[model samples]
Target: MDLFQPSPSAHPGPELPELLPLGPDGIVVRFGRVVSPQLSAAVLAFEQAVQENLPDGVTEVAPSLSSVLVRFDPARGRRDQVLTALRKLLGGVDWLAETLPPASRIWHVPVCFGADQAPDLKTFCQLAGLSSEQAIAQITQTPLRVLAIGFAPGQPYLGYLPPAWDIPRRAALTPQVPAGALVAALRQLVLFNHASPTGWFQIGETAFRPFQRDRTVPFALKSGDSVQFHAIGSAEYSALKNRSDGLGGARYEAGA
Candidate 1:
């Protein structure tokens, strides 16, 4: 059985997407309470639509796990007007049935697992009832879609892992995991953008720096991108770490 499913009933209201006010400068168009692939598709679709037919004075449109945050200049755009425009757009389409937009890029990130880089791998494998080899195979076998980029700069929340990988967060935090740490919990993977403590288990480590201010395009990954984490040897990982390009031995193809 699947461990998680969409729970539209979690909120008591109309089944349609909800538009909630986000301060004077922004509004949130929430699709549903749960974070599912379908809802993500809807959110992205709406995000694309808003970008295509941008409202007057609207400055930014960002998609979260289940919502699209539309920000505007309060001086140029009134809250009521933006809300009305958003409501009309929301009502015009069956967003939930909309197909996911094509990914902008697909990344193949090389990672070194079950060594010093992945300090929590043994425990994570134990929780999933899989041996280290088995765990690695399952994780590397499939490319996870980038659900939403948040919680940190350029950090990508990738999911949904198979049923056996639907593990929960650890009861306590792991003091700190380095930037490029591949952590997992709640059937999702979060590629850390910087060294930070987390409740998620550190399953692997990649040299890919998702956020690098020095580069022309600082954020390496974006929402709707796909990531394939291929296993690499410790030596190869070390080599990638020393390179100056900052991609960490990862390459991408356009229009994934």
Candidate 2:
């Protein structure tokens, strides 16, 4: 069965936080099929809980939009043993009601949303029924949470912009977008850490380097961190283009 999908025949019980094997050495703890802040909270809480109380053989815990992937060492323990430990841990608390962890950091990243930096800006503005200026205002006005970091090293998925921005991903792919490209779709924004092909519309560009191998912490943004984007002129973006610091033109606070 497709473990990720909701199949009544595959899982008849009403109990949630379901467990499905992800192969011999991994298990997927699914909170639900939908993606929302509350679900994300549960995933984060469970991830933290697992980290604090891992059974033998468990090697890693990674949280995604609505689930946690628990990987383990097959030689250390059997899947049933790990499942038993997870079941016990899951029973210890009501994870669904758990609040998000405290914000670890806050970032104010600068972006240039103009035509030159963002070639697809006009296209997206048209689709959202927004003018160029209006689009920039909407995107920069609020701070989005760093929901998850994937697709590329240190790349962040940030979102839940107003409903009007709840657009779908493009039908066709854009051959390539450079590192630091800011794209939008599904009411979320993705800040690319490296050049890549994508289906999301390119709406802006930033100088921030989310991943820097030279840094002690290669990934700049952690999952629970907050990020607010501010607009910058072309000249300013040019000035901040490639500074020694990997932050580009972004500034951050230690704690939320």
Candidate 3:
């Protein structure tokens, strides 16, 4: 099946969304209570629609796991007018049939797994009932989609791993995982963009810096993009670390 195509055996149709006020200047269009590929696709489609045909006062449109948050100018775009326009737009479309925006890109990221870099590898193997090599193989084989970018700057939540890889977060937080740490939890993978404490299991480390403060385009990834992880040796990791391009050793191809 196409990645963006909703599974008919699973999801019947595009979910109905609720447009609720987010204070006076913002409105949130929530698709559902849970996260799924179908819901994420809907959220992306809705966000694209809003951005392409923004109402008079709409200033910003942001997509999350299952919703789109739209910010508008209250003075120029009254709440009722903005809501009405949004509703009209929503009423005219079939979200499941909409295509992802053209701006999406696919990324191939190199990771060094199961060493000093991946402190939680043993723990992850224990929980997943897999050996160290098996765990690494499983992760490297799957191509995960970027569900959303939040929780930190340019930090992407990527996934929909197979059933066997649906691992939960650690009960306790790790003091700190450095930027580019490839962590996993709740069936999703997160590429840390900043050094921060996390409850997710750190399975690998990469040189890719998704958020570069000095770059013209600060965020290297976006929602709806696909991420394929490949294992790298310590020597290659060190070589990539020395480069100054700031993308680690990763490369990109433009498409859905």
Per residue, candidate 1 scores C-alpha lDDT tens digits across 91-146 of: 64788988888777888999999479989999988989989998888789877888
Summed over model 1, clashes come to 0
Please say which candidate is ahead in TM-score: 2 or 3: 3
Worst 10 residues of 1 by lDDT: 1-10
Predicted structure 3, TM vs. truth: 0.85
Stretches of candidate 2 above 4 Å error? 1-14, 54-57, 74-78, 92-99
- Candidate 1: clashing pairs of residues: none
The residue ranges of model 3 lying beyond 4 angstroms of the native Cα positions read 1-15, 92-103
Better model by TM-score: candidate 1 vs candidate 3:
1
Residue-level lDDT of model 3, residues 1-256, one tens digit each, is: 3322223454344444677778879988888878776777788888877877999988888888889999999888987788777776776467756655554677899999848789898988898888988878878887778878898889898876766667877778899998889887777888898899999899899999888889878898977788889999998998998878778889889874
The global C-alpha lDDT for each of the candidates, from Candidate 1 onward, is 0.83, 0.83, 0.81
- TM per model? 0.88, 0.84, 0.85
For all candidates, the clash counts are: 0, 0, 0
Clashing pairs in 3: none
Residue 83: error of model 2 in Å? 2.1
